[model samples]
Target: MRRSKTILLSLSAAVFITGCSIKPEPLLPKDIKSSVKKDLQLLSNIVKPITKAITLEEAIDRAVNNNIRNRVQKMESALAYKQIDMVYYDMLPSLAANAGYSVRDNYAASASTSFTNGQPDQISGTPSYSVSQDKERTTTDVSFNWNILDFGLSYVRAKQQSDKYLMAKENEKKVTQNIIQEVRRTYYQTVSADALLKRIVPMKDEVKDALVQSRKVKLQRVSSPMEALSYQRELLEVLRSLQSLERNLMNAKLELSELMGLKPGTKFELSEKVRKNYDLPEIKMALEDMEKVALENRPEVLESRYKERISSKETTTAILKMLPGINLNAGINYNDSDYLLNNDWASYGASVSWNLINIFKGNTYNKIAKTQIELAKEQKLAVSMAVLSQVHLSIVNFKQAKKEYELSKEYLDVAEEIFNLTEVGNDLNMNSRLVFIKEKLNYILSTLRHSSSYANVQNSYGRIFASLGTYSDMKKEEVKAKKVEKKLVKKIMPAVEKKEMKSPTFKTYGIATSNLNVRAEASLDSEVKYVLEKNKKVEILKTISIKNDVWSKIEDGYVSSTFLEIQTTEVK
Candidate 1:
């Protein structure tokens, strides 16, 4: 009764302490200010400086290396792998060691009576009392326990978690593919805007001035009211289009900056060659091969396969849980007691336990396991169908993008001729500029359309690559660049590089830029083995960087990777 009162009082004290401690606590303004300050500092320090104009290859590398989304996916995969370790530990036997000290106001006492023929007799000395325990004592217990049924269930669960880690990796791959697609689309748009913004800005200024003057002319009645109104209306339409186009171009710059994981309003440049010209990506792989590889590398399909494995293992777990549990326990114990004969002891035993209630629920558990397996299978089938549809749609869209780009190119050619003819006739002046502004607007509009069409073609091309799930080329360049100083960089033209001491599993190819030199070694001074004329296809063995320049090892010699396209290839 005394011990029960102590325990109740302790519980009440704990409740009182908890009640005293509890209160609504939110971030004060000062705390929020500090947090924001730290975050801003981290953002500024995290990104590498844009040392030079970024190429398409370099931009993709930055997105992969510095983008928070990619970093989070990688960390999540690492976390899942660590969780597998946690699950494996669950299969291990539990061991516990506990030592306790206690004090009491009175000793543990007991008295006994003996009876013979229904008559009770007390021992000599009247008030009989015996004490076996002291008021203060210490105890130590070390125990080991293992349950066979629980171990089996934990082992099955560990297997499922192992597959979950692999699924995380597959999801990471999917995120990387999407990032690459986004990089390609934005990189070109940024480049085109950089080149055309100069023309756009001047043209916009002139139109704004023209609109202001025309409004003044309308107010002064310098011309017929209808003519002046019509002129002002034309100027307004031109100004609106110019402003809209400029806004879009500016938006493209910001989007590219963000995609490359740079700070807002960060200044950077793109390579001169790419800024001045559009390098169309080419995929020479057969459609059937493309489809075949898509099945092999697509993250959705791989993740689905892992889910099927997990579901199968879960059924095993269900069955393991229904069996009888056999618990094995062993312990060593020690205690200090003045009246005890032995102060230390060792014990070991096993106990088998069965839950009779679970026997009746066996059928229900089996049905649930079976249903989980079916769901996994159905989901796998759905993912496969979706992947196939994406690959086919990407190809069709790519072709249409190319056709549209070609048509835009033709229109640009005609517009260029008209602009040149007007310039040759000296038909442009402050007064006539507004009269010819429509002609100039058509020409500039054609230029923007041509640039946009090509960017779309590039975007569609990258989408097909992303859908097919090929990032080997980009990954190799990032690694190769890191070998120089251990960061994602491709200051030299980025090309796919892999070690090839022996024949590789698949063939990779590249095209020559103008006249390419195949050197005896990866250096400018090395003897030229042969020259590859412009646009000749070369089978790439591997690529490596010496200093900052990159070189691709062809069948017999090395060629500079600066002029070669890396991301698109025939994977056979």
Candidate 2:
């Protein structure tokens, strides 16, 4: 009893000490400053170095390849895929090995007494005492348990996981499309800035000179006070507009830098020549066809379909839970004891257990599961409707952008002609130099407008494709995780065969572990088409997950996934 009290007191003291150690502590200012400095330095190092001028195509590539948000989505899709592998383990039978060692200060002793009728015969009873086990001993056991109900549940869960992985891939596609759109918009704006920066700088000096002359004219009364004040007002208005444009032009480069995942204030040059149509073949499709395409390819629509599958599986899982369970258990156990006839033995047994009370709740649970499935279907339809709306809206925006581009082009031509005539001294109200400066500024404004309007037109055109989900086929024909093994993973899931993944399905880096054979299909029995050299880099196009094995369709052909490592992103 004394020893027990001492042990309890020791445990209480230890618990108090641990509790004290866990008190909340705030970071010091110096520590936070050091962390910030370290992270900024690391951020500067990871960005790929730029060479020469960056074109629109290169800008898109940089954003897709290095944008932190884009990379995160790729990693997320990969994580979801890996989870499918983990859930498969849960479906397997429970195999466990246990080992134990025990010691005591005294032996475990039991006494047996002789009895008469239903009670001990105190007058003639004899009692015996025995110690059957050693004071110190070791025990070990290995067990295997399989439950039919649990297996069914795990199978359903795996199906859900497969759908989830596909959904994540679809989301990644949506994010890539967004990145491309953003890069295109920023690239054009930056090109406009680069083209106008030099011209705008010299014009500022002319405007300042004109403003000073107008102020002097007003003070000396060389002209009417009203007319001189009006001239100064014109000069001031032009300067304000020019300054605003300059500020906007200056920030365009910064926005592009951040989008491409480069450090802030990183200086880089852009190609002055804008990619008018971005090298993409003209998008020509009827509204009806576009709607059809959007419905077929939009990530939101696909994600909804995947969600519906998850819900249907949930219904099946619920049913499995309500049914009876049959468990089969087998184990082998051993004991180290001096007084035992058999120190090792095996056990086998089967059990059927049903909660009769669950029958009362079965109908309600089934209804709830079915209702959830209906909800998922409704959500899918809603997403499909939204996708169609975006398609129509993108078309309208494209038309408006086209008209604006034409109008800006006309304005630029007229402004340039007027500036030329004034520079030759055609009556610019007698002050041809100042008037020429004003005309020069107008021409510059028109040029800037032309660039901005054209950029909008390109963005709107891309939006049409983006809304249709065809932007998935981007530069290099590879937007991050280009939809993955949809053509195959779909057949492997969906409770049936469905949608196919269109090319190019993404290419990620992987290495062959051996002289791996590339098969015609995701099976061993399929004909082996080619062999890969060990340790060679393989361009993985599609990844398929089958029962216990994984296969990747690479440039050569389908190879065992176990030998290939998929790197979602790499820092160089």
Alpha-carbon TM-score of each model against the true structure: 0.77, 0.74
Q: Cα deviation in Å at residue 149, candidate 1? A: 1.0
How well does candidate 1 match the true structure in TM-score terms?
0.77
Candidate 1 regions exceeding 4 Å error are: 1-22, 25-31, 114-126, 272-279, 422-432, 473-572
Off by over 4 Å in 2: 1-8, 22-38, 112-128, 214-233, 272-281, 426-437, 472-572
Q: What's the lDDT for all of these models? A: 0.76, 0.77
Q: Which ten contiguous residues of candidate 1 have the minimum total lDDT?
A: 491-500
Candidate 1 C-alpha lDDT tens digits along 173-199: 899888888887888788678766767
Look at candidate 1 and tell me the lDDT of residue 531.
89
Lowest lDDT sum, 10 consecutive residues, model 2, at: 490-499
lDDT of 2 at 419: 48
What is candidate 2's lDDT per residue for 1-572, written digit by digit as tens? 57867988999999999988996789999999999999998888877898878877778878988899999999999999999999998899999999999977678987866698999755425556689999899999999999988899898898899999999999999999999899888887888887777667667776787788778778888889888877778788888888988998998888899889999988888864532222222445688988998999999999999999899887787677789999999999999899989999999999999987777777877888899999999999999989999999998998888888878777765664454334322222425445766777777777778879878877787788899898745353333312223233211111101112222222356687778888989899999998888898876665555655667767767888777644532223
